[model samples]
Target: MKADPKNVLVGSHYLDGNHACAEGAIAAGCKFFGGYPITPSTEIAERVSRRFPLVGGVFVQMEDELASMGAILGAAWGGVKSMTCTSGPGFSLMMENFGLGIMLETPCVLVNVQRGGPSTGLPTLPGQADMMQARWGSHGDYEVIALAPDSPQESFELVIHAFNLSEKYRMPVLVMTDECVGHMTEKVIIPPAEEIELVERNYTDKKPGEAWPYEDTKNLLSPLLPVGKGYKFHVTGLTHDQRGYPIINDEAQEWNVRRLIDKVTKNVDDIVWLEEKDVEGAEIVVMAYGITSRVVQPAIAKAKKDGIKIGMIKMVTVWPFPEKRVKELADKVKALIMVEMNYGQVFLEMDRCVAGKCQTYFVGHAGGTVHNPEDVYKTIKEAVK
Candidate 1:
């Protein structure tokens, strides 16, 4: 479906990643937003607060991050495409409810504009440290789709992809953008509303009493019915049967949890998005994502000029890990280098996937700022040697 013309800012404009993300949400038919303001990510909420009302959407600044997440989940179930944005401390507060969204198979978007942190660390600085947390923050077993945008333009494009993926997979999707990308300004060209495609929620056709909300379908996706639509459905975070009713048993546990994981895992090829370059006969492959991907381009160019055949994989989808592609590259490349603003969170995953097929190295920064290009260049030189 094309986006609503009234909601699209269809022209060239200089935008920061936060504002670009807001425009992306509006263009993707997201009509409801609930978020608590936090440094680095507050601009997204602020932008949405001003823009949503003009497009017949709603923006609610909740009392806390917990309520923010909860409200979005409710809004999603209430037949609105919903989202929330936050930074580190607030991201931590939203975890349990994030899990609830997953358990109930609610489709929504969560944007974490990452900052340096264990607590209230660097509010205004950039960090990619939350890469692992996006995968494992919520308790229990389930899958999530997360995209990392390297620039304001990508921040605009990828959040729409995030929402589309969320609706397609029937799970909470995450945009794991960092403070640098969120704050950096760049030109973003929003295409005409007719050019923008959106995925609408697939509603169940069965009447209220005739259908189960969580009924397993051939596509591994269940249709959702809006509340007050005469759908007699129960939604809960507990282990439940296909009927969405609690069922406490080993069989029920395996049935419910396994599907949650497999929904994305089994459909990984469709969910995984990566931009690869120069892979054929390359001795070294530089794997990076988000802000780090942009920062490493100069280093990669330098490596090539110095006669090192270095390939690059810019991860667009951060979660679902792209293990198969990593393994394929591991077999061909002599060494793999993972770069990021965090201290080797995704690097560890790369190493795990490589599994002794080739040498794996991590180019990590502690994350108040981006890595120095020279340092990354030196690492690439070292890897080639």
Candidate 2:
């Protein structure tokens, strides 16, 4: 489907990532935004609050992050596209409900403009520390799709993609951007509505009593029935049957969880996105995402200038970990380097996937700032030795 002509800005402009994200959400047909103002990410809410009313959408500044998450979920079930934005502490608060969104198979977007934190570590600084938390924070067995954008341009673009994925798969999708990208100002070209593609909600074709809420389909995805549509269906966060009633049995648990996991794992090829450069015959490859991908370029340039056969992989989709591509590269390259603004969170996944096929190295930072290119260059020089 095409974006609504009423919502798209339809011109080039200099915008920060947060504002661009807000514009993207509006263009993607998101009608409800429930969020609390958090540093770096607050601009997104501010922009949405002002723009939503003009486009016949609703923007609510909820009491807190927990309420913010709950409101979005409720809005989604009520037949509206919804989202919320937060930073580290707020993201932590949203975890339990985030799990609920997964269990209910709610299609919504969560934008985390990350800041350094175990708890309130660096409220206003850049950090990529939430990469692992996005995958595992909610607890229990479930799969999620997460995207990392390096600049304002991608911040605008990927949020739209995130929404498309969420609607197509019937699951919550995440845009794991950081303070650097959220605050960075850059030129973003917003295209006209006709050129921007969107994925509409896959509502069920069956009438109220004809279809079950959690009916098993061949594709492992069931269509959603909007609330207030006289649909007589139930949905709960517990292990549920096809009728959406809680059933506490080993069989039911296995059946319920496996579908949630398989829906994503089985379709990884279609969900994952990566940008690779000079990888064909390179001796070593540097892997990075978000702002770190941009941070490593000078190092890569230096390595190439020294006649080192270096390649790069920019992880556009951070979760589901791109296991196949990493394994293939592990076989071809002498070494793989994982770079991020945190100390070895995602690098652990890269190492596990490499699994002794090739050497794995981590260029990690403690999160107030991005990596120093010289340090990365030194690591690149050392990896070849």
Best candidate, lDDT: 2
lDDT of 2 by residue, 86-179 (tens): 9999999999999999999999999999999879899889999998899999989999899999999999999999999999999999999999
| Candidate 2 backbone overlaps, count | 0
The parts of candidate 1 lying over 4 Å away from their true place are none
Kindly give the stretch of ten consecutive residues in candidate 2 with the minimal lDDT sum.
225-234
Per-model lDDT:
0.92, 0.94
Clashing pairs in 2: none
Give per-model TM-scores: 0.99, 0.99
Clashing pairs in 1: none
